[model samples]
Target: MTTILKPLALAATMTLAFAAPALAQDAQPQAPSQAPAEDKTPVTPEAWAVHLQVTDILQHYPAFHSAFQGPNSFRPQATTGNTVDATLYAGVKPWAGGEIWGNLEMYQGYAPNNTLGAAGYVNGDGAKVGRSHPYARIARLFIRQTFDLGGEADDQEADLNALGRRRTKDRVVLTAGKLNATDVFDTNKYAHDPRQDFLNWSLITAGSFDYAADAWGYTYGAAAEWYRGDWAWRAGVFDLSIVPNNAVLTSDFSQFQVIGEAERRFTLGGRPGAVRLAGFVTRGGMGRYDDATALALATGKPADAALVRHYRSRPGAYLNVEQEVADGVGLFGRLGWADGTYEAYEYTDIDRTAQAGVSVSGERWGRKGDTVAAAVVVNDLSSAGERYLNAGGLGILIGDGRLPHPGAERILETYYSLGFAKGMTFSLDNQLIQNPAYNRDRGPVDVVSLRLHLER
Candidate 1:
C-alpha cells in the first residue's frame, strides 16, 4: 500500500502548490461597501465544484482462542492490516435545476481477519475493498434533476456529494446511473459515515438488508425522491452481482433489487429528529439454507450452498432513527430483519439485528472540534441458517468449523476523534466481539484501529 500512497501524496502536494497560485491570482480585496449584503449567501454562480478526500486506517488485533476453525474462519493470531481510500468528487450544474456528478476513487488493503467473524464487521471501509494493491474505479456517476414547487427556498451547503445551491422546501429529485444505495436510503445523521463516524458495517447501514452491489458496494441504479415540508419518499432499483459476493456485476437485468424508504423530520423538545423506514426486495439466484443442510446430511458431506442454488426473491426491512439530544450530543438506533431462509447474497450473514448508539461533540470538554461515539450491536441467524453453518457451510464472510453451541454475535464499538490541524483528523477506535460467527466456543476478541483523514 505504501507503494501506492507515495505517488498519491506527491500528487496532492503538487495540486495544492498549483492551486495556491491560481487562487492568489483570482483574489481581490473588497471594500466594505463592495461586500455582499448577506455573509451566509452563496456568492459563486452555479457552475463546477470539486471535492477531495483521503483516508488511511490501520487496524490491529491480538491473538484469541477457538476450539476449531474452518476454511473461512477469522485467524486466531495477532495481526495488523491497513487500508487507504481516496476520492475525487466533481460536479457541474448543466442547466436549471440539474446537476451531473462523478467520483473517481482509489482503494487498497484488507482487514486482518480478511473481514470475517463478527456480523457487525469492525472495519467498514476495509471490508469493501478486497485484499489487493491500490486500484482506481469509478465509484459514482450520476445526474440529479430537482423540480421546485411553490414554496420558500433553502440554501444547500457544498459537501461531499452536493454542490452549493438553492432549492424549494417542496421539490422532486430524480437521480440515475451508478451509485450506492445507502446514499439515498436508511440514512442516520449520527452513524452513517465510516470516514467520520462509526466504523462498523452494521452501524453505518442495515446489516440484514443485503442491498445489491459488487465487492466494493457500488451498483448501477436509479432513484426518485419527493420532498415536501418535513416528509420525504424515496424509491430505487439496482442491479445485483452475477453471483453472491462475486466481484463482477450481472450485465443483464435478470437479477436486481427494488428499494423504498420514507422519512419524517420533526422537532422534539426544541431539538431536531428524523425517522426513516426502509425496505428492499431482491430477485436473484440464491441458495436456501434448509436445502443445503439437507443435502449435506443425505450425502454425508459438508454443506454446499451451490448445490441448492435457485432463483427466488428475498426481502428485508429496517427502521432508523436519530435525534439531537443536546447542544452537541445525539442518539441513534436501528432495527433490521431479513429473509433468513436464503443464504446472504451481499453484506454480512445476519438475519435479525438491532443496534443503538450515541455521539457527542467535544464542546462539552472544551475541545470544540472533536467527537466521541459508541454503539452496541447484536446479530442472529435463523434456525436453518444456523444448521447449515453447523454442517460447515460457508457464507459470504463467516463460517466456523462447527457450532455445537450457537449464540448471537454481539459487538461493541467506540471511537474518539481528535482534530489537531486544518483539514486533518485522527481517530482511535476499538471493538469487542463475542460469539464471533455464532460459535460460542470461540472467545471474545479485541480489535483496535487508528485512522487519519484529510479533506479539501
Candidate 2:
C-alpha cells in the first residue's frame, strides 16, 4: 500500500496544481434550476460553439489471493496505473438544419496489465493500446442533419459535439463519419460515461453487444434516428476492423456491422423513464470456438482462434432500461447475450451479461453538487466458450494458459463524486471483482481509484 499511496499523492498534487487556476476563476457557482423557463424566443441555431474537458484517473489494487498465474492473468501483486486525456470539441452550424463537429484529443498512460485479465476491466478510460508519452488523434469528426416532423419546438443545450439549437420534438436525425457506436446505442443516464459515472467496462455498455470499432473504440459509420410521440428508433451501419480485434478498420467496406434499436419513453409516477431493445450483427472473418479447440487438440498445439478464421456473421442483442424513480435518484439495468459459438470480434470477451445499479444526488443531503452510486455486474461464458478456454484458447482480452475450474465473473463498484467547483469534480471509486476472467482458481481482486475531471 505504501507504493500505491506515493503515486496517488503525487498525482493528487499534480492535479491540484493543474486545476488551481480554473477553480479560482469560478469560486462561486450557482445551482442550476431543474427546469428553466422554456426559451420562447424564435427558433435560432448557434453558428458555432466550443467546449473542452480534461480527465485524469489513478487506480491501484493490493495483492490478492491467486492459486496460479498465466500470460493473460491479473498480477497477484500490489500495482498502480494511471490515465490522462484532454479533448477539445468544436462544432459549427454549416446550414440551417445541419452541423459539423470534431473532437481533438490527447491521451497517455495505461491501465493495469495493459487492460487485460478480466472481462469487466476496471477502467473505461483506458485504451487497448497505451503509451508512456502523450499522443494526439482526431477522436471524432461527424456531420448531423435534422428534419423537423411537425411538433412543439425544444431548445437543445450546447454541449460536447452539440451546437445550441432549436428543433421540433418529432424529428429525424442523420449522422455520418468517424465516431463510437456506443455514442448512439446502449446508452444509460445513470451508468454511462466513465468520467462522470461508473468506470467499469461492463457498465459503459452492454458487455456482449460487441459494437464495431478499432482498438481505440471508434470507426467510420452512419446512423439515422427517428423520434415521435414517446417512441424512438435508431439504426446504423459501421465499418469493422480488418480482422478480429485488429487496430485497423476496413477501408473497402468488405467487413461491417449493422445495428438497430427501438425505445419507448414514459412517465412512471410522474418521473421520466425509458426502455430500449437493441440488436446487432457483424459480418467478418472469424472462427468458431469449437473448431479452434478441435484443431488445437488434433495438432497438439495451443488453441488459437485466428488459425481457422472464415467470413461469417455473429449476432447479439441487449435490453437497456433507465428510470428516474425519484427526484435526483435514478435506476438503470442491462441484459445482454451474444453468439457464444464464435470468437468476439470487438469489445471484451463476454458471452452473456447482466448489470444493475442505482445513483442518488446530494440534494437530499443539502449538497446539490454531490452524488453517490453503486452497481453490480455478472458475466458468463457459454459451454462452447468454456471448453475452448479450458483447452487453452485465447480471446481478445482473456486467456489463461488453461482453465481447470470455471465460474462466472461478478463485480461490485461504488463511487462518491464531490463537485468542489463549477465544472470540476473529484471522485473516489472502489471495485470488488470475484473469479476474474471466469477462472475460479485465480482470485478475488480489489481495486481503488481516484478521478479528477474538469470541463467548460
Candidate 3:
C-alpha cells in the first residue's frame, strides 16, 4: 500500500476556518401520504429553500501501541504509528431541488501497522524521515438533482397536493452523475482525522481494505427515485468514480464499479414519540478477500486480480425516535440491522453475517455539541466450522477452521464530546474482540484509545 498523500488535498484541508454549513441536505426517504394536506409545500420558487455549507476537520492520532505473544505467541510484534490527517468540505445548494458538493483530504507521514515505534514513516531504504508529507490524498466532485417523487412520512395513502421527497406519487425523482453519501458512524470520517472512528485501532479505513480515505475522494453516480406515496420507491446505480491520479485527472475506475440500494419506510411505532421504520435492500459491485488472494496468486498483483464483482445484495432496517428523558437531557436512538456479504472476499472470511447495532445519543451536562452516547454492534457469521489464527506464523486451528466463534462478535463504545471552543473534543474507548473459532481461547483482545479533537 502506498503511504504517500497529496499536498493539494492537504492545503485545502487547512484553509476552511470560516466556511458556512448546510448539513440538513442528507434526508431519509419516506413512504406515501394517506391524506391530502390542507397545507402543502410546493416546488415553486416561493417554496424552495436554499442552503450552503462549509465544514473541515483536522485530527492527529499519536499512540504508543504494542502487540506481543509469549514465546509460543503467534506473533510478538510491537511498534508505534502516528498519522496526521486534514479534511476539507465545501458545498452549495441554491435550492431544495439541486446541489453540489466537493472535498479534499491529505495525510502526513502516514505509516501502516502499529510498529513498536521504530518507523514514523519509512522510505524506500527503510529509513525514517520527515519533511516529505504531501498535499493531496484525493479529491471528489459531484452534483445531484432531487425531485419530489411520492409520499410523506405520516401518510400511508396518496395525496396529490403533497410534494414527494422520496418515491412519492407518479412523479419520478432522479439523481444523476457522480457523488458520495455521508452515512457512516464517524462524523469526522469522509476525510482523514485521527479522532475519526476506528476499527481494531485501524481507521475504519481498514474497510478501505486498500483505498485511502479522502476529503472528497468519493466519485460520482446517478440514481432515480419514483413514487406516488404508498408503493413508490428510490434506487440508484453508481460508480466508485475513483481514479488513478487526480493530477492527470484520469477518469479510470480500473477498480471502478457500480452499486445500488432500495428501501421502504413504514410506521410501526404507536408510542407518542414513535415515528417510522425502514427496511432496505442493496445490490451491486462487491469484492472478495479470498478472491483477491487467489487473483494475487494467479496474476502476482492486486491491480491484475480479477475482482469478484458479483451482484451482491444487502438488506437492513432502521428506526429513529426522539424524546426527553431528563431535565437537561433528551434521549434518541436508532437501531439498525443488515445481512449480506460486502464483497466476494467477505464470503470466505465470513459468510452471511448479521450486522446489527443500536446507538443512544442525547444532550450532555447543560452544554451544546457537548453530548454523550453509548453503542454496541454485533457482527456474526455462521462458520462452516473453520477457525485459524495465523499470528507469528503458527496456526491455531479449530473445527473446519472456517468460521468465527459460534456467536456474534461484538464492539461496544461510549463517548462524551464537548463540542466547544477551538473545537475541543475528547473521547476514550475500550474495545474487546473475541472469537473462539478463530483465536481458540487465546484471549478477548482489548484495546483502549484516547482522542483529543480540535478544529478551527
lDDT agreement with native, every candidate: 0.83, 0.87, 0.32
Better of 1 and 3 by lDDT: 1
Rank by lDDT (best first): 2, 1, 3
Q: Tens digits of per-residue lDDT for model 1 on 331-356?
A: 89999999999999878889999998
Residue range 35-142, candidate 3, lDDT tens digits:
888865443332222222122222223332223232222121332334444546555555665655554555454232311111001111111121235455334455
Cα lDDT tens digits, model 2, 196-313, are 8889999999889899999888999999999997899999999999999889999987999999999999998668999999999999999999999999899998888999899999
Best-to-worst ranking by TM-score: 2, 1, 3
**Residue 324 accuracy (lDDT) in model 2:** 75
Full-model lDDT, candidate 2: 0.87
Candidate with best lDDT: 2
Candidates 2 and 3, the one with greater TM-score:
2
Task: State, as a TM-score between 0 and 1, how close model 3 is to the true structure.
Answer: 0.50
